[model samples]
Target: MILCCGEALIDMIPAPVQTGGTGYVPHSGGAVFNTAVALGRLDVPTGFLTGLSKDLFGEQLRETLGNSRVDTRFCILSDRPTTLAFVRLTDGHATYTFYDENTAGRSLFPDQLPDLPDEIGALYFGGISLISEPCADFYAALAMRDADERLIVMDPNIRAGFIRDEDRYRARLDAMIRRTGILKVSDEDLEWILPGPGPLDEKAGAIAARGPKIVIVTRGREGAFASFSDGTMVTAPARRVEVVDTVGAGDTFNAGVLAALASDGLLTRAGLEEIDGPRMKSALEHGARVAAVTVSRAGANPPWSHELSGPDPD
Candidate 1:
């Protein structure tokens, strides 16, 4: 099972109401939450590890997990309020304004972390949860601690506005990247991580040199580029789709790559270290296909197993 560790919250998105005014509608979302649900919907054995509130929004998030077939036994429940991110869209792109002070998912302490069982072969981490305090440290520590035993996959999904301390966050990310087997980042994320004067692939390569066996740099509509630690590079083109909104596109893309790797039995620690160009390219293509379906719809809703063409990755 792949255990996704990070924030899970409600997204209050804008909608057109009858009076020609914008109305906010609540949707269950968060980067890690989206990936976990996407994995579950794709029929991968998945589990979620995060702090959840007893609030109504938390209940909605939990129900979404259950419906997607994700295991929630690892969730830490509390009376703290749930985090809410209000989203704005412009021509299919998305922006978020978050209200996340002392929320359940942001307040997780290291002591509250659950010990994982043998079934969890991989651990995925990312999003604003990595920017929040107490919980960010908690997750960073968890990822480093479990690195030796399981495959560690991370997509920082960096949101610059949420980071309070640039130095501290960069340090934390550097440490995590050293232990990460697969590292996925956006073009903007790559630029921020290694700012100034370098080609995208070179910058990605620099990151790969730090530690990750595989470094995937997603280029929005252009698609994704990957660099393996063993000197192999591959690229996958984005699928052409009439995008409705890009809410969960990257999150679902991460799930698709993982699912494809899992299907090819390359999700294991050793398998990742020995990954070649073709296999990695195949995984990226699969991710593009999955993400295409996500962008073609509304919200963070990823396609169900039956929705994709060909044999199920599960």
Candidate 2:
């Protein structure tokens, strides 16, 4: 099973109330949470590892997970307040304003972490968990500790707005990248991490040099590209769809890729290292398929396994 490690929070999404004015509505989401939900919905044997609260929103997040069939045995429960993200969408894009101080997901300590079960063949980490304080340090340490024992996948999912210390965050990110086996990235995320003066491949190469056997760079509607440590590369075109809002496109895409990898027996470190162009292409297709379903709807809701066989958006 793939264990997703990161934050869990409630997203206050904008909606049109009866007054014909905009108001906020709560939804269960967080980068890692979104991916875990997507994985479960796709019928992947997935579990979540994170700090969750006992608050109403937290309970709601928990219920969402349970409903989606995600294993929650690894969660560290607390009475701490749940993190809240107020998301604003312009056209079909999403931006956010977060109120995350001292929340359950952000205040995690290393001791709170449960010993990972051996059944977890791969671990996925990303989002604010890599930049948020005490928890960030704890997560980095956990990923580093298990780097050699299992497959490690990371999607920096960098949100420049949330980073508190540039140098320190960069150091933590670089360290995690070194330990990552499959580093899935968006073109935008790449610019944020490896800023300026070169092409996308060169930037990905720098990270690949640090360790990751395969670097997957996604370009929204254009498609995605994968760079291997062996110096080979491949690309996949994104599926066309009517985007309602891009709330959890990247996270669902991560789930799709993992699901595809798991189905192809390439969910392990050795399989990733030996991944070929066609296999990478097929995985990217899965990611695009899931993502297409996500943005075609409202909020961060991804497709159910059976939903994929339904009607087309366009």
Candidate 3:
């Protein structure tokens, strides 16, 4: 089982206008939330750990998770309002403007964390959850204190505007990276975390030296690259598709990778490192293909297992 820990909130996306304009449409989203839902849709045994409000929006969010078959027994319900993010689409990409200060999700406490289940093979985390206060401390502690038996995957979905304190954000990110076993980040994320001149290979190598056994750097439509501790590196180009929106593509790609690993019994660190070149290539290709399906849709909708298993693009 793979457990995803982070914020689950409502995203107010722009509605397509038939009269040559744009309007807002609310959808359930949050980086980890999207990943968890995608994993659940793929028939992966997945759980989500986070705080939710008892408000109407929260109810809708919970219903969405349930529809996706994500286990939400660990979710905490609060009287506080649910977090909301306004999403704007431009050039096939979505930009989020969040409203999470003092919200229920950001108020998560360490004591609220559910016990790490023995069945859990991996723990996945990232996004604004690492930028908040008590919750940030809570997740950081989980990353540090958890035994190495379980694989810890982290994706630092960088949003510079949401991070008020640059120094604190960098420190927390570095700490999280050190604890992560499989670190998946985008090229934009690397630039935000480590801003400097030079090749990204050097940047990725520098990050790898900090600890993670594997690092994947996604380069949008150009494709993605992965570097392993064994000094093996591989790249997979993005699949061509008529992108409707790139909102949750990366998050769904993460789901695809985790789902593939879980299905193949590769959720453990040993299992991960044992993956051969062909298997690794397959995993990367599968991730890119899954992401392409997501990009071709609207909002955070990812492909189902049957959809992903269909024929590849010719």
lDDT of each: 0.93, 0.90, 0.85
Better of 2 and 3 by TM-score: 2
Best by lDDT: 1
Candidate 1 TM-score versus the reference: 0.97
Q: List the candidate numbers ranked by lDDT, top first.
A: 1, 2, 3
Residue pairs of candidate 2 with colliding backbone atoms: none
Please give the range of 10 consecutive residues that has the lowest summed lDDT in model 1: 305-314
The residue-by-residue lDDT of candidate 1 on 1-314, one tens digit each, is 99999999999999999999999999999999999999999999999999999999999999999999999999999999999999999988999999999999999987776788998999999999988999999999899889999999999999998999999999999999999999999999999999999899999999999999899999988999899877779999999888999999999999999998989777778777657888889899999999999998999999997899676443
Residues 1-314 of candidate 2: C-alpha lDDT, one tens digit per residue: 99999999999998899989899999999999999999999999999988899999989999999999999998888889999999989998999898989989988887766788787889999998888999998899888888888899999899998887999999999889989999988898999887888999888888788899899999987889999887888888898878899999999999998998888777776666657888888888888999998999999999998987767444
User: lDDT of model 1 at residue 147?
Assistant: 94
Task: Give the residue spans of candidate 2 off by over 4 A.
Answer: 310-314
lDDT of 3: 0.85
Error of 1 at 175 (Å): 0.5
**Deviation (Å) of 213 in candidate 3:** 0.5
